[model samples]
Target: MEKKKINVAISGLNNVDSPGPGIPVIRALRESKLYDVTIIGLSYDSYEPGLYMEGMTDITYQIPFPSAGQEALLNRLSYIQQHYPIQVLIPNFDAELFNFIKLADRLKKEMGIHTFLPTVEQFEERHKANLPEWGRKYNIAVPRSQMIHSVYEIANLHHSYTYPLVIKGKYYEAGIAYNHDQAVGHFNKISAKWGLPIIVQEFLKGTEVNVTAIGDGKGNMIGAVPMRKQVITDKGKAWAGITLEDSTLLDFAAHLFKETHWKGPCELEMIRTAEGKLYIIELNPRFPAWVYLAVGAGQNHPEAIVSMALGETVTPFTTYESGKMFIRYSWDLICDLKSFEVISTRGELKL
Candidate 1:
């Protein structure tokens, strides 16, 4: 059978120590049974490893940073569309998702580009700063957290939060601080990179588990796979993980989707305590770097979302192979400097 051809554009290709979902998502799309994908890599930096990974992207275009504002991003996409004609766009970065979500309708109407993403309300409510209230509204357990915009707020945190708390930035980066000085240092460091409103969350003692799931716009869970991190990096990213047959985690994902009617991909970062109580630590609005594990396990969430974005009705995936594991490794790609030079100077490269 001839597979349907799909022209999909994806971003967040900085596959480094802390990787992004772009390459993994592209991998899933390449392996899809339903679609023959032409991967268009959207990159912010010339050094993004996915741009140079052989056979990974058919073409790569360097796009403006999210700080450049929505007009700049749309203009760039419009130009790219004139050349490559993107049918579906998947943005993988937290910082960039806001612009994508805001432009979803415009992208669909004006550019005929489809994107399956959470609504602005859904995105805003699940923010790290708003997790406490989101949890209360959904009746789910979440770690106590406080958002502070200034480093001076760290001194006052002791009255409300104890030692050994986790300090997180608004978009990315986090550090566990054990004392007042460490908390202040973390606040300063994260605030510098991601800006103010650092979140101080009560450190929960538990095993970290994550769920990579997808939801259709109308309150149906299209697919979900829960995994337990076997090995963690210094940056708290899962270096190795194994799929699990955890009903509780699956149920939690289903309930969240039903209540919020969340659209597109989401990763629920939760902790299972010694008493087996689960607490949502964070809610990433898009696919995680490790989402390829779900494809290996049986549910191809990235593919499913692409189909959904293109207006296809997909049946829910009820099961995945338990105990399937993903171990992340790095390999050096020997590429000619011409590839780098072209991308750096011309801002586009066709492999």
Candidate 2:
């Protein structure tokens, strides 16, 4: 049988120590039996490793950051589509999801670009600022949290929160502050990077677990896989993780999908307390760095998502092999000066 060839474009290609999901998603797609792939790496920075990594992408192009507004992004994507027809675009960054969700319809209508993403309402409801309220509405346990704009706000935090709490940026970065001084420092540093309104959540004592899953946008969870971090890096990334057998976690994820009708790939960050209670920590509206573990556990969610985006009727994945383990590693790639200069000057590299 001749396998159908599809050109799939993906973003969030910064496969650094704190990696993104692009590379891993690409790997899973490349292993697919449904289609042969022309992996298109859409990157924000010229030096994003996935753009230059061998076997990572057949072609790569630089695109504007999400904050550049939707029209600018549309123009750039239209230009890319003029040359390489992108069948599906899988954007993998938290900060960029808003723009993607907003533009999904336009892209499909104007440029034939397809994407599977959560609706704007579902996306906004999961923000750190509104999480506590959302948790209550969904009948889920969420760590008590507050959003603060000024560092001075932390001074009076002791009234509501303890000295040791978790300080989180609006889009990224989570730091544990053991004291007021640490809290102030994290607040300022994170605020500087991700802008105002850092999240201060009561530090819940528990074993952190994660679930990487995809939703069908129809109150159906397409696939869900649970994992436990066996080894973590200093940055708190899972350097090594193993798939777990946890029906409760899967049931919770299904409940979230049903309640929100969550449409697209999402990683639900969860914590299991000592008394066997589960608390939803954070909700990431895209694939996690450890998404490949889901693939290894017998569900290739990325491939399934791409299929769903391309208008294929996909059945929900109800089962998977448990006890699979994923160990992450880093390697250096040697590249020529011309390759770097081409991407830097022309904003693209094709080979």
Candidate 3:
């Protein structure tokens, strides 16, 4: 007998204008017809853009975080469970995972809701500055980086490294500095506004490539797609990307799961230097926002994620349209309009 569709809840829908990675994941799952999907938003606002998935999901519920910390997240999850009766919870953001990790075991043990995720230790390495350490441990080339716990630390080590270094906030995005003064200037401002240690890195000039994948915890590769950023926004989401098939890069991705026992979807950023060598830049344990392209190219990563969570075997993905580019139409166009002021309010501007 065919099993009834399982209920799945996707959390962390914070905006509507530009949907996040989870949006595509949910959409893919809905298309797959493999599960009874529920869309969940964690903000108290009750109007997350992800609620747009209401058309696709079996149910839509918004459980606002009740406090300023992890407790608030747990409270919301509890509310979601009682109200929606979802059997699986897929968190889309780092903050959501941080909360889910606290009660992952409890959620599974007490409520029978499986939270598919890496171990807390693995999650820590993936989201924080510690990821480069994994690359080093596996002999993966990583750019020179120094962890800065405070802005003052930058001043002390400014002389140790050359200019064009990167100033990265521990919990925020990074910025490039062409000289010691520039590094310090950006470091001071970011630290004052964003807080904590920043990673000072030697910026590698190269093409940035991102590889997205799904792994089965036990060293088995389920799905992978290698793509390069053809165009990127200042905020770092790839506005356009060209797909490629490189087993060598896939090997590096395989190493990560082999070493960390990672399960679920992950994206690794790599920089190909002028010398043609690729260096691992960072790893995101969650779905890459651009995953929609992979799906469009015939790699259904989100469905693979669901299969893994359900203890089903998945085939390796060997399909991708090499060298094809996809531009995020809305965001890229909006960026152009805002930056160039080329698009007039009344009509499209002529160049």
How much lDDT does each candidate structure score? Answer: 0.94, 0.91, 0.68
User: Residue by residue across 1-351, what tens digits does model 1's lDDT show?
Assistant: 899998999998899989999999999999999999999999999999999998889999999999899999999999999999999999999989999999999999999999999999999999999999999998878999989987888888888888899999998889999999999888888999989888999999999899999999798999999999899999889999999998989998888888889899999999999999999999899999999999999999999999999999999999899999999998988889999999999999986
Candidate 3, residues 155-257, lDDT tens digits: the string is 6775777777878776557788886677788888778876766778778998888888877777766777889887767766677888887877778777767
**CA deviation > 4 Å runs, candidate 3:** 1-4, 15-19, 41-47, 52-59, 64-71, 331-351
Candidate 2 Cα lDDT to native? 0.91
Cα RMSD, each candidate:
1.0, 1.1, 7.6
How do the candidates rank by TM-score, highest first?
Answer: 1, 2, 3
Task: List the candidates' TM-scores in order.
Answer: 0.98, 0.97, 0.84
lDDT top scorer: 1
What are the clashing pairs of model 3? Answer: 15-49, 16-49, 148-197, 149-197, 164-178
TM-score of 3: 0.84
> How far off is residue 48 in model 1, in Å?
0.4
Worst ten in a row by lDDT for model 1:
149-158
